[model samples]
Target: MVTRTARHGSDDESGDADYGHLQLTALDGWRGFVAEMHTAPNLLPTAVWTGLAEDKRDYYDDDRIDHHSRLLVVQTPTIRQVIASGRRLVQLNRNAHSGRCGLMVSGPAGTGKTTALTQLGKTVEVIHRRRHPHAADDIPLVYITIAPAATPKMIAMEFARFFDLPISRRANITDIADAVCGVSRDARVTLVAVDELHNLNTRTRTRAGADASDTLKYFSERTPATCTYAGTSLERTGLLSGTRGEQIAGRFEHGPHRSVQPGPTMDRAHRRLGRQSATTPAPAWITARARPLPAQAHPRK
Candidate 1:
């Protein structure tokens, strides 16, 4: 049986009627109208699309993947560091009974924090699949996007979907938290990535006092999974300076940055005041007025 709830809004020419007033046939007609609005004219189906629209959109779509690949090209060092840290966490989890760690990857936008975390999760999943090909599928990682309007219950529900856990609408915050912890414990998930953490403060107004530091600490304390907070530098500092920030900081081990050399197409010698080594490539970009030079011209004297 279908249940309908009337939302507060302006009524049409017809007097306001409870949404439940629509008969099955009328509901079908309404569904057809919506389908016509969204579908391409030439491809419209004879039957109407009657499915309920989903609120959560998949974050890792094809476009997202392409964007991430380009991000990796520009932020190779950060990507490498994130991958290495994730691998270290996986190894630690395998070695310890109470495997818990935390990482805060902070940088400006377009710096590849989300992309790095996504890559890390994929790497862990690949390793897990190779190790236990025959066993039942286990969730090796969980990724959640925190928004400003996010509540503890909403976060729990998102985690529930990720783990394919059955969650009733009546489920409380504690219940959802328990489900998440339970899944991590049973599935041996290596890490949990929380993206857009800055959104957390915006989403949960009531839980504004809920210190991210404390929540993260409690999560790590109760689960064997490492928690990675990927967001802006400001968000990272806020979390790190929060009540349980020290605990969070202690769990993570930071990696060093690596310098990248420009490609062969670019020339560095003319750009530099002093003579340069033949082996070193030029910077990626050059001014439009600069003249192109032969590779032999860059040879060491």
Candidate 2:
């Protein structure tokens, strides 16, 4: 939410009226545009507030949102790190430059780790496609969510599905990996996001998680795309355990410890991440910070 001070006309307008007017004015420039990291574009119409009673309308139209939640992505320190890492990855992938670049985003469940990646993927897709409009088969960004109890085969199948390929479940992991990597290289997919990475650790006292991590490591090593692994405390999972984990960790442009937190302290952190140069050829990383809603403001389920 944006806060603005407005001058109320001495004539019938009270402070509340002036505030509402100010808010509506702010929405004028923002309408129809999705803020960075936000899931949906702002569709609020300013004209609706012209002659309506204050209590007659909601500031945000929930009906405008589809089944998916439209919560905005706040670019706290963690998000900035993710964006910077993605930019660096894209740079490395340009002109077939080989680099085992990756990024791991880990935090508590409600810390917006998935949300950050989702928006980042969307942003990267748009920017990359716009820059290379004539390049067909150039799938700049592909996102794959790790399912519960997902195996390496299952994960490889997910990739095949994402690419709309018809691969049987009985296919060998090596074959699946090769097909996916070949397609990724041909398609020029610059970034690949694997969400809920912690799910690999579901089977404890076994090497299942390690094997899953190995698949990811192999994929990262083979492909030119930047791999992003995100989940709840993903760094603490088996994905980051032992010697192999050390090798994977070294590929990250940013450390796993960085994460977004709520409140004024977070605001201070955002200010310190340094602004991106406008003249730089890289995509402009958005730096909007979302304000926290009051405890009672959430709508009841």
Candidate 3:
């Protein structure tokens, strides 16, 4: 009964390239959360939103209607496993007597690494909403990306910006870090997701990069929330190299990384054998033609 919407934009001016919004809906009790990617306004939907008025929907043309508005959730094994691990980390942070814990997800580009973490944040937000339904103030998860050319001070500033804390432009890095940790604790943030952590290890700012790594470690040690980092292959980015990188690595449990696939097998016998394997069932959907029918009827149909 809880939902949070996250908006993202695309560069295409045509608008069709835009993804509507990411949302999370919590199911009954504390069972689980549903993650949805809605279609951008004016964009075609693969399905219609549930409970839409009969008169307002088009029963026939899927491209003419917004199927993405519906309560559709795609729970791939990757997403489910990531969500489970994140949930466990949150619980660990919640019940632990002291210190903190973390998980890291690494993979190549276009591997849905960010998507997994985004869904996990949505679920965490839903849990926070359930607990503080009336307050509407607590943020269960905090998400931030290390900006290009970021330093330890810049990283601290990003947290300050997220919490909307008004701090002096001249505040030292130490002060900013302290402020971020205090706010995170008081807000009861269960998880902190740092995306594009690869940016921290960029070569231009060698000294600053090392400091940035240490800054993240400090955040993990001082904050109550579990920190999850997502980036291109951690090893390739040198994210876990050097003394500070090693320190950061020691604090985190490396979760699954989407492994690069081996080259295609060219064996004709293997291909022939694969073709003989059993077929999978069609996806469950009620439709007219190949397009799924809207849950609600159209007045004309």
Candidate 4:
């Protein structure tokens, strides 16, 4: 069974602490985990809202999103391909006997890899609910963003957190893996979106020959849920090199177009600004100057 500590909040507040705020602590812990190979107090947030205002902005700007939906955006073609691959996995989920499938989307920053996967997640959730109404309790999509400073232990902890599982530094890796697998198995989460996968690159410094690739391979081979990687194309290629590439490609091949409209087009900008200007209050002088020019100097008749 998974146990999670309740987030501390003022009694005056009506709601629980936002999950995004907790992610900062989780991310900090991930960084410490990489260096120390153990969980530490550094994972706790100094201030809950420190870096999250921007995330809120990004969250709102996501396309095809509604209050109940969670969306992420990606701009790169490779990342888009990975999201497409995730869709294919969900398709295969209809054939449960086929086992698990993994999808890799790699690319550089500002390429919109995360954004693409987010849009894909929304689609998967809707499809899964439609296909398996009986399993409505299950989260159709689980989106996990890898912190840049993440460690294997931190990764495990994040998974535990996501499923509301109890986690301590003393927990065993195999146990953590089992717990994660169990959650996916039970929840029927058709797809797992892992963004910023390159964070696992630190594992390369270890003598065990582990790297982000190894971590990717572990998730690919272990979890029943379809895994999708969202990163730069260059990063994706690097991640796919060697044995792991084969595993990723074998499980999921590329599929059809799943693109969303890119954010904030120039036309949209003009419309928004024009509307704002029209409604905004004007200075008394400006308002008086614009007083219909004395009814068009009587020219209109």
Candidate 5:
């Protein structure tokens, strides 16, 4: 997402620092964002915050929010698995000729599909940065989101936008696709990520989805990258069902980022809780802290 720098008035009292317009799809923006992600925000404890004067807390409060935001995404097991599989695949497909195997992360929305996928890219990108610290032009990852009702040209343009390729108004889909593919190849981009894959609905009769699929296929084949995707119920969307879908699925490894998992029933859980609470004795520390309430303070409910 692109955000404009906050415009502060001359008379404004709060002087919050502005981290301007972070759009990570582009190279400069992405590099800045990665740096930002690495720089964890420092927040003081509640006692320190309470001691601070109200007039000087705006900046500190903002910092606290930043710290909390960074902590929101916990690295779950599934994300770890995705990162492992993606790294392995990129290495596995490095010397492949064509029809390279890919990774697809699918589950319901809000299941960290985007998070897992982006983390995969960051993991690889970090390794590349560490290996070739001086190679600034060696961008090893590309991430783009599929817009709603996106066409083949639209998908190609997202790639062009990420690489910041110069595209004229009269340029056709082939022009954009070729430019993107050439830049990706030149940049030695090894991980190509497409988020919001659910937006590219191939069920439509206009053949736009099919064409979009072809555009993606072209990228996977033309550019030396492991194409990874994240979306909601991709199999149910019929994205991996048709002739092309079957071929794509045949070469792809599917991973589920499911939010729901089978576990002990609620009744069993309640009984377990009851048993623990009824039989367990209070700790000495808790007993020491407790005080008997007056009769007026504890009228029977």
Candidate 6:
């Protein structure tokens, strides 16, 4: 499945693709990130021949180095499954009142948990756009991270900030919550991703922690969006401990993540990397091309 020879779409031919970082939590930022996309670059020329200018050859070398450094994301099954499930859940929860289901993605580092989380958001936004082409102002999704040692008001402020709704310094939790819910409803948002949720483990046992959990519960109940929480090893973190934990566990559908194992998936990933290295005439090849040849170097051949 690693098509090293495959060329990407004509859109990428421009080579000015803008997938730059946008303030993902903000409405404009989220839309900007979703609208701008990038895919794998076409395979660079493999052989050095006569007549291709040195500057152009150097350009090819530079392009390959830049892309390889960033690396390509293999579209694994787990990521595809999560994107599909998240899309379905949003539609399923659109009309539900209470007991609306949510998603939980948990694993250790390097598992691509956050990557899958954002891909789901992108998929949801794309589908929404197809359905409502004229609704340019419809935000459809909001993403934010859970701050450590965060209180009830602090939690409310996170959501409010995403909408860029100015919150007065004297505002209460109620004031902020009202603004977030109202703006999200108007934007017709149906999905929300909250990352770094494992940070909540520290606040799980205290009054502030309990209230923080309650604050999230209240928002989920009030907001129509299908919420998703992604973190690392949630079961071990005490995030799902006690009454608050029980509430979250009961409402959320737990999905376990798998690390890459020794198999075709691993083999394919390795092959792709090797193919990329060979195709671009990797750094070693570039250096050899630059250095002088010895007396033994064949000229007649």
Best by TM-score: 5
TM-score of each: 0.57, 0.64, 0.65, 0.54, 0.78, 0.74
lDDT of 5 by residue, 213-289 (tens): 88888888889899999899888777888798899889999998854233353345445555665689964423532
Ranking by lDDT: 5, 6, 3, 2, 1, 4
Clashing pairs in 1: 147-199, 148-199, 148-202, 148-203, 149-202, 149-203, 150-203
Candidate lDDT values, in order: 0.55, 0.63, 0.66, 0.54, 0.77, 0.76
lDDT of 4 by residue, 75-145 (tens): 34544445566677667765665447666555446645655676677567666667776874676666677
**Cα RMSD (Å) per model?**
16.2, 12.6, 9.7, 14.5, 7.6, 8.2
Give residue 215's lDDT in candidate 3 (0 to 100): 85
Instruction: Give the least accurate 10-residue stretch of model 1, judged by summed lDDT.
Output: 37-46
Model 1 regions lying over 4 Å from their true place: 1-75, 97-99, 201-213, 235-237, 254-301
lDDT of 2 at 103: 73
The residue ranges of model 4 lying beyond 4 angstroms of the native Cα positions read 1-85, 93-100, 202-212, 235-237, 249-301
**By summed lDDT, which 10 consecutive residues of candidate 4 come out lowest?**
33-42
Question: Across residues 1-301, which tens digit of lDDT does each residue of candidate 6 receive?
Answer: 1122212333345776543344787776677667654444444444543346786665655555555554545566677778877887888898898788899999887788888898899889888989999998888888988888778898888898888889999999998988999988888989989988777774454676677778888989989989998988988877688887898898888877765554454556545554665577544433543667797895876
Candidate with the greatest lDDT versus the true structure:
5
Identify the runs in model 6 with alpha carbons over 4 angstroms from their true place.
1-22, 39-63, 69-71, 202-205, 263-301
Each candidate: how many clashes? 7, 0, 4, 20, 0, 0
| Residue 79 lDDT (model 6) | 79
The residue pairs found clashing in candidate 6 are: none
Q: How do these models rank on TM-score, best leading?
A: 5, 6, 3, 2, 1, 4
* Worst lDDT 10-window in candidate 5: 3-12
